[model samples]
Target: MYNPNELLTRFRKYLQAEQLAKSTVEQYCCMTKYFLNYHKCGADRISTSQIISYLVTISSPVSRKQARAAIAKLYFMLGNHQKMNKVPAHVGFYAG
Candidate 1:
């Protein structure tokens, strides 16, 4: 049961722990915020399927690559899925 705030806080920590650039962390957080909002702010109750579906929807509404990268990070956080396998290579995940 990972609360959204807790999730985000940990995301922030992960960014720092992973040594991601500060700007990258900010961008990832912003992307995640939009994602969280799109999912109705489900907190710790959001499911993987819902997250994947949401990623598909937002991919068109927003930057498809960014959407994919965000989802990949989420998968990493959730620890239940493969990053590259779940995210398409064309999503610009490897761009940055």
Candidate 2:
């Protein structure tokens, strides 16, 4: 079974390696954790639909955008998802 904490630890390391600011890393990780919790699944199993659903639940536009960016960063760290600006058409709705 995939462990979210282990994956998130790797994500934190990846953020450090990329030289992201400490606060930025924290925010991103927090949003990613929320995402993981919402889906009740491992990071590797997170889907585009799940991401959209999570974003939709955020009432604040600013928070919604931030969460979207954070999820994108997490996906980038995992090495499966692509750049944020170039997210697929299906994901554009939640990109904000």
Among the numbered candidates, top TM-score falls to 2
Could you list the CA RMSD of all candidates, in the order they appear? Answer: 9.2, 7.8
Look at candidate 1 and tell me the lDDT of residue 17: 87
- What lDDT tens digits, residue by residue, belong to model 1 across residues 1-96? 445676778788987888888977877776776666655443434544555556656444545566567667776776656534432222222111
Looking at candidate 1, what is the lDDT of residue 75? 64
Q: lDDT for each of the candidates?
A: 0.60, 0.60
Roughly what TM-score does model 1 have, to 2 decimal places? Answer: 0.59
Off by over 4 Å in 2: 41-62, 82-96
